[model samples]
Target: MANYLLKRGNLWWVQRKFPVDVKDQLGTFFRKSLSTEDADAARLAVPQRMREFDALIGQVRMARDEGDLFANADEQPALDQMLVRYQGQVLSGLSNAAQRRHLRVLEAFGAFVGLNLTAQQLASRAKPVVEQWLLPSFGHTDAGRRALNVLIAFYDWVVECGYAQPPNAFSGYRIRPIKSVVVSRKAWTDNECELVLTSLLAEAERPANVLARDNAWRLAWVVLLGLSSGDTLHFVCEAQRQTHFKALSADWHKTRACWPEIDPYWVPGLSPGGPDGRRSWQLQKALGRRLTSLPGSLTYTGLRHAAANQVRPDFDAWLARLQAIDLSPAQA
Candidate 1:
């Protein structure tokens, strides 16, 4: 049995008996029997809690000399070390996936900021330091959101698992980030596009500035096909009209405006410009013959821009193009 002493302000003192070695039960009994709405409770509770505190101090000194049962490898029974032991015992035995989240949060932030803090020290906690100071800037990004989610899930788990005797420090927290959209992406220049178009056309067209009517129309056809295939551009050209979702698929009605389940159809010896060699290449070749044109190569990406950019401008059009194919704008 241990006797607790009480005090009033800095002067009066009283004593009583408390019978436990546990920490919380003593603190609770100390707070309740001593604290009051009126001066009388403070007067009554102080001396009693102080007496209990003295008993606990004596018990601590005795235990420190008794044995190493409560000691760790370092032989220190500090609160930090003690909490770790409690965590290993209680947190390890708990099978709850959700509750483990809080333990993770405690492991992350509790060591430096939360645990072993004075009541005055809590006013300078780290959670708000990150949320109010750091997260305000980065919280909008994917990395920011992920970090906040990890901490929150852990905090929720901790409280749910009864790791704390009361509410956890993480509750009522919000992690909203600022919203902003990216408006631009890289696209090939018209001169660069002209070169790429040449590569996609017939072998005879590679060095020839003067393209036949069929080649010009073929290039135009291919360019339009690639561009409108993106989300931003909804319109389709003549060749694409047949395979375009509106004309080809019954599912387009149900799939909203999205790409749905379309797969790429790769074929050799075909330019995106047009399979039909029917028009306008003759005029291009004559123009090229009239004045030698600087040549450009048509790559897969270049052909895509040539086909699409005719309808939409660079950024939104590129974005739309990516969206139509179900690719992310971030990739663009």
Candidate 2:
């Protein structure tokens, strides 16, 4: 037969001749190791191997004739099943973190549409999901960009496996910067840091409720810690005593990879989903009010850049100078 099993040393391999029209593109014969040494195993593997080879042949032929947009006439599987197969077969050997992220992207896609939907159905609905869900939700972040790339790659794999049609619905998506003015993560200048700290300290010292006082204090440290420790506003909001900080002077690099600590001060009234919904939002609101007096649009991210700039050969010495500044009354 044209497609048959062959013995290669100790393993069984599948060998098949390419159609004449696609021989130049796909080679004369497709040869793949079946990873089995037993003849019985090779014989059992025939039907599935034949199906895979035939699907590949159909994809090449369709790509040539219909330009990658046509699906094979064969019955297609459910979207969920296809995703699982794609992850297991196509991305089997990829890094676990990458694989997990890809699956998460796929899951997000499925949530937007329906996992039970077929490839053809998914292709039809992809544009709206791309514009509405993907762009609005993730258009600004690096993870979003990576997810778009992964989605495109997954579709390409689906087309190649004869699981879906082509011209890939997600192929046109691109990752662009969210802001027109692309500023690098610049740390706060010495003058800017002094201005920010002095302003926040004044706010913290004002008579206020525990919630208001704690929010003001933490928000201030968020700026100082962001600039000095390179921690994000989000990280500052979610910091915990047991996880993020154990003592005043702690080494974040020594902690687990998932939990990164930055600030030395322990926040008293910080809780998950305070009256403002997310604790991060509370910090954001407090910081936003204080930053209103400053020139230019200085985001917390900018503070992180400022702190990064402060990192020099004498980082400890510079940190000591920052630590020596009196914020004890506010901290108390």
Candidate 3:
């Protein structure tokens, strides 16, 4: 009973008439035999057959539009040939890793625009396609910016080499800016610092592996050092030797000045390189995890702020008082 359903002899068929504009590319009438005598079966077959007809029509329209856009498409250099020439000329100086990264961005672009287009056709259509299709596909992220940058670079090369016209498609295209949220790093209060140090000291006393106990002790020192001196974890982890109160101290690596003497604190029998020869970063990460397991949300970096908070009106006095504070388990 559908409008497109027809009967020719004993067999049912589905047919549609193409629009006047596309009739030349497609035919005047689209027809496919349903090969069913039953009216109910023919109706079911008509919908699927109509979908196929519509798909074919869409393909014809796309082909017609492409043909119109590039009349002498066959005369232009193919995309693959252009890429090979561009690689040899422009990307030859880059390292293999850098070249591969560029290729990945190019490959994603090629997959979207397709390889059938000539370098000239692509260059002509690049701006609209990149702004509308390519950028939106990658979204507004670091990856999207990288992709945009690579494409712009590629087109610049294309124009310089005389393969394409001037005014790169992606040259001025700007991806939407990423909005960032500001997270406040709050300074730990006196009671909070005491609680964290007490927990770490308690952890150090428990029976555990040498590495675990060493890390707990090191974290306690890191916290104490940060609180007293307002120095970073990196400075503490990288310290080669302990400076006692009476010793003439060498210049601190970060500040290039002699650091004020603090009470010597060292993990018993643990090397400066850390237990089991672990790197500074590895030790820092382990200490960070141990710190995270404690009750408060304040990180190791927050202790520096706590030091400044305690300094208030007098820095030297506060540092002298904090330096003599004992970190022994009973005193913690």
Candidate 4:
């Protein structure tokens, strides 16, 4: 057997063999606890540890054969090559925007440790590169955690591709939670929603700049939709125009105000500019000013949550009717 799996106390111990030639430089066998007592759990964990051990053995064998593994490989591979392959094959399922974000994470890591460096060069010094450069660059935030996650995937891919070895240096790292940045989300109150609607409705009626009217009209729609439907801001903004939940064709392009026949008022893509595209920030600021009780950073998401709460009385009434129906049948 290349490695041994033994149970010591309640934990499963994975003992990997060290190369006899480099036994003095390394050791006889490297042992680590798999930290599980269950045999099935230990069996599931063995493949990963085995892959890691096999990679370590390859490194030792390579070093013994050629002075260094890096020296033995053909023209040093570019980091971008692996990234391209990874994106095309592994990340093909992701949306364009999601794929771009993952690429940015990879790019950030590349920047952390010069883009020109190969996977082998990176894997060799993973610990220092992560601790000194990667972690520090990201700080202790959600973005940092995302960066680490991407790096772990990248390293794992490299290992699978035979460009790097096992025991992926960046694997098993957890992001340290930073409590200061956490914010508790709260829904908007009825009074607050009313204030927003009143302010925007007045602005929509304003006979001044056509642009201002357009902006107000868009915000009013968003606010009303969010307050009633509980749709997400992204959905509120990007969802195609629909008449009674049925999608509108591209040829049906006309502002909801102009297309009363199409019944576009209740649809998402209502505005001539198409759902407050460029002016969304301005609209957000305007709504923020009206609802002074909430932070200016508040968006339609909070508004929608509050709007959902507005339906509670209706929901309760419906529930009561359902119970009444059951009781009537029983009483008769």
Instruction: Find the candidate with the highest TM-score and give its number.
Output: 3
Cα TM-score per model: 0.29, 0.39, 0.42, 0.34
Off by over 4 Å in 4: 1-76, 181-332
Measured with C-alpha atoms, the lDDT of residue 290 in candidate 3 is 67
lDDT of 1: 0.41
Put down candidate 1 lDDT per residue, 1-332, tens digits, no spaces: 12343446653344443322333234424332443345454565665567666677466445544546454443333334434444444443444453355445445555545466532243335466466643764566665665566555444544444443334454445556665532123344665543433433333233233233333333333343455454222132222323444442333222223323242321111323324452323433433342234343223344445445663434333223323332112222
Residues 181-224, model 2: lDDT tens digits: 54435445667776776665565556265455445555555664
Candidate 4 lDDT (Cα, whole model)? 0.60
Clashing pairs in 4: none
- List RMSD in Å for every model shown: 22.3, 15.7, 19.1, 19.6
Query: lDDT per model, in order?
Result: 0.41, 0.65, 0.63, 0.60
RMSD of 4: 19.6
TM-score ranking of the models: 3, 2, 4, 1
Candidates 2 and 4 compared by TM-score, better number: 2
| Model 2 spans > 4 angstroms off | 1-73, 179-332
Top candidate by lDDT:
2
Runs in model 1 with CA error above 4 Å? 1-86, 89-107, 110-123, 126-128, 132-169, 177-222, 228-332
What's model 2's TM-score?
0.39
